[model samples]
Target: MLTVQPLQPATFPVPGQFYMLQAGASYDPLLKRPFSYLSAENGSITFLYRIRGKGTRAIAALREKETISLIGPLGNAYPVPSGEFIAVAGGIGIASLFSLFGAATGRATLFWGGRTAGELLMTETVRGLVRTAVITTDDGSAGRKSLVTEPFREYLAVNAHLPVYVCGSTPMMKAVAALCSDAGARCFVSLEAYMACGVGACLGCVVKIRDSENHEGRFRSVCKDGPVFDASTVVWEGQ
Candidate 1:
């Protein structure tokens, strides 16, 4: 959890844009990584990210008194749920569901999968926002000792009418998408990509697809156009 400090408030998340967070002065790469907002209260925004490298380690190691820079509340939020909602997440994917749960009024079913019970941070975070079940790979933990999508599929089998949202590793997303689609369930996905720039100026995060909007081309920016897309709309080429 991030604490408010000698605040440096900035307003720059363009509904679907991102911010570059320069955690500290120790940036060996001379810059910070980009992050999407999970949720924001008052003026604070939440980011869901994993520790992977020196820079990431640097920020993760900071104590409560130490503060880092936050650059946004960016990116297009997923469409507000129109009906019963169910969300399936893997690893840190639960972050994507934060916004969804915030806007939902009906009972929400959430299935979060992590490597271990200790990693299910978002599970507890959503307690007040919605109903959640955490699943861990380690059998000794809490919920089922299966992949996050396993429980998702099981819920889909019985509650086929609920609208489903998913975010996680690409392979996991694809696997669940296929199963959900076959079962005739409507699904949405929030995607992840390696980004250098958080805005649309960089054409680095492009996804190939058959343009249905105008049929002009077959390319779209993941960072700009979406980090989220309907399961049926995404042209998961090469998958």
Candidate 2:
């Protein structure tokens, strides 16, 4: 968990929107890393990230009040659900969906799952914001001993009319989207991709999108067109 306060007040980012962050003045890493806003308030923004690589390790080493480069509230945001909706998050992917849970207030039911209990950060924070939170860990260190999607699928069986919002590992999102498709539920997914440029100019972060009419797909810039997209339009790996 990292919280950064801008030198000056900035616009709070919408849920599912992200910022490109470069740790120091020197560009040792060259490209800024994209991180979704966990929460933005009171002139500060928070990001929940795991230190997986060079970029993240560099970000983790920064001292308090050190200067860093930030560019964003970038990409499209998740639409606010007008009625009751389901939110599915996988591991740290909850960072992108936290604000949406608040946006839906008491109407959102959250299904969050991770391989271990430690992977599920801010469990109390989620419980405070959502109507009902279903937690699962593969190791059974926390909630049920099953995949997060298992409970989500069960819920969808009973209430397929509710819309779903998801952010997670690509495989998890693909599986959840498939379940939603079978259940006739609308599913919106927030995608994660390696980005050279956070803006649209580089054409580095493109994903295949299935055309609604032809079923043929076109490449769309994830940075520009979406980090959030309708699940039906996305061409999953096997499709």
**What would the per-residue lDDT of candidate 2 be over residues 1-239, giving only the tens digit for each residue?**
88999887687888889999988666678899999999887788999999987788888999998877889989999988988899999999999999887776447889999999999998997898888999999999999999999999999999899999999999999999999999999999999999988888999999999876657789999988999999999998888
The prediction achieving the highest TM-score against the true structure is: 2
**Model 1 stretches with alpha carbons more than 4 Å out:** 4-18, 63-67, 132-134, 138-140, 213-217
TM-score of each: 0.83, 0.96
Overall local distance difference test of candidate 1 = 0.69
Model 2 C-alpha lDDT versus the unseen true structure: 0.91
| lDDT minimum window of 10 residues, candidate 1 | 11-20
RMSD of each: 3.1, 1.3
In model 2, where is the ten-residue run with the lowest total lDDT?
99-108
Clashing residue pairs, backbone N/CA/C < 3 A, model 2 = none
